[model samples]
Target: MSVGKRAEPDPYSLPVPGLVRRVRRIAGISQRELARAARISHGVIGRIEKGTSMPTLPVLERILGVAGLGIVVVNDEGRVIRPMLDRADAHDGADRRYPSHLDTILDPEPGEWWGDIYGLARPPETFHRDRSRRDMQRRRSQWEVRVARHRHEPPPPKVPDYY
Candidate 1:
């Protein structure tokens, strides 16, 4: 996507790239200028502006700080305004709130618990069994092919050395 283009429509609010573009326009800064001021690469800024990359809290803060802006999240009633300084806080509580026992069973390190719970926390034993079966099939195929050598195969031709 081109820089300064919004990737999606927002039902209630502007998407990140649109907001970034608006902020940049209000600050009277170009993409290159903003990247330099934010001390980030132009490509990163372009990705952010194109809504392809979601910057981390620190990176977003730095970029927004350059434009005298910060990410603000509002409640449904618009009565509460919360600055989005923590990435974890961005998740919907229903999707993220784990049961106490499950959380204890999968004690993920900070900032590392966002992956699929089944795959990341405790993968099924069948995963290794499937991998071993696939490996055996590949090796059996190679052995079968090697054993089926053509009897009429031609011999290698010799090449003369150049002076």
Candidate 2:
């Protein structure tokens, strides 16, 4: 059978929900109890375990923390990978008071590239609003086109003979 242009699913994605479930079980907690401890809803835990929703990094951290575990992105050989957290701590000197170069780059300065490209360098609200608006617009446009096509197409005439 022919299929549309869908990407092949990755095997790695299958383990995440199971891992979360195992961790919660190991901690001897029910889904509702874990959700309460994690400051999220039981439905969120159910959704995460069912692979219907993808939690953000911070939310994942909180969930894992509540289960007496923490997220550790690792390679196939089990090497710990801390890309974002390490980058966030790269420039911490003995004083430990100064911000890293990333902060400067990310700050909404007059000459920053992010500001030039996005109109505001570090306003997360802008990114969130833009993403939601674009998604809604795309869905609306697709529905409109479908409705227009249906309106133009005529139904088949009633058949007099039956096989």
Best by lDDT: 2
Model 1 misplaced stretches (Cα beyond 4 Å)? 1-14, 81-163
lDDT of 1 by residue, 72-141 (tens): 6665588667442433432333545323212122333433333344355431111112333334454555
Report clash pairs, candidate 2: none
Q: Quick one: best TM-score, which candidate?
A: 2
Name the lDDT value of residue 58 in candidate 1.
85
For candidate 1, the per-residue lDDT at 30 reads 91
Q: Which pairs clash inside model 1?
A: none
**lDDT per residue as tens, model 2, 49-82:** 9998877778888888876787667765999976
Candidate 2 residue runs with Cα over 4 Å from true position: 1-14, 82-163
Q: Give the C-alpha miss distance for residue 151 in model 2, angstroms.
A: 76
Per-model CA lDDT versus the true structure:
0.56, 0.60
